[model samples]
Target: MTNDFRILLKEDMRNDETGERWFQDIEIGSVFFFSVQASTLHDSTPPALLDDVMAYEAFQVTLQIRHGVYNFGKRGAWQHLEDKPWWPLFEAESPVLTVAANLPVATVQQVYEDLVACEKAHPEMTTKKCLRSLSVC
Candidate 1:
């Protein structure tokens, strides 16, 4: 009864000539290691506080613990006003993969902590995984 997955990070850059957004860069941010089940994808996984696609889910698995490999960096103070948003990394964009998303990206650690205390706790997860932290020691 294992059906938990990790969230990957995507980077977007706007073209200087065309001013088009692209989702050219996708990096593995943090990952929660759980046994994959066939029903994980089709079944209702944990609801995303943020708008992210569902990777896996299970009735017994509530997202709590996570292991991060790379940092998504701190949240920027960019607002969607008439002002310009601070986006520097562009030339490295894949053009084919990059796209625009102004919403603040949640850190892996933050997401983990949130799910642990989520009101809609999974039946099995609420009793186990949700109580743990990112560390093993």
Candidate 2:
């Protein structure tokens, strides 16, 4: 078996029917694990000392996703992102989100799918540049 693979999306969310937390990793296939804290973006992080954000939905991501990510890690204030093609690992549902970031899982899934489509179509631009250049939409 190969030692490396790409992760398209992952979710450690609560099971609606059983009220139990579940773990899901989506790559070419799915892997499962158990999590006690389902809705949390970071189980280990203390609540962020944001100026105004009361709560948010967050994810663990690769550093290449955003320009400031590596510098942010250098500050040694939080955990560093993963090192791989997953380089830009975390993405906000949007630039700014509010209230549990309470989007449906299907919607969140679609956002990642759209990101892949964007990457495929642009080939040379980062996701940010693609969306920014397409500013008409």
lDDT of 2 by residue, 1-137 (tens): 22111132233454444433333533211111111122333331222322222232332222113321112233211122123233233343432111122333333334344434433443333233434544321
Cα lDDT for residue 11, model 2?
39
The candidate maximizing TM-score is 2
lDDT of 1 by residue, 1-137 (tens): 11122333232443444423222222111232211111222122342222333442321222212322111222111111113232231121231221222212232223234322332332232223323543431
Error in Å for residue 1 of model 2: 26
Give candidate 1 misplaced runs (Cα > 4 Å).
1-14, 29-101, 105-137
Error of 2 at 85 (Å): 27
Kindly state the number of residue pairs that clash in model 2.
8
Q: In model 2, which regions exceed 4 Å deviation?
A: 1-37, 40-100, 126-137
**In candidate 2, how many Å is residue 76 off?**
28
Please give each candidate's TM-score.
0.16, 0.28
Error of 2 at 128 (Å): 16
* Candidate with maximal lDDT: 2
- Cα lDDT for residue 78, candidate 2: 19
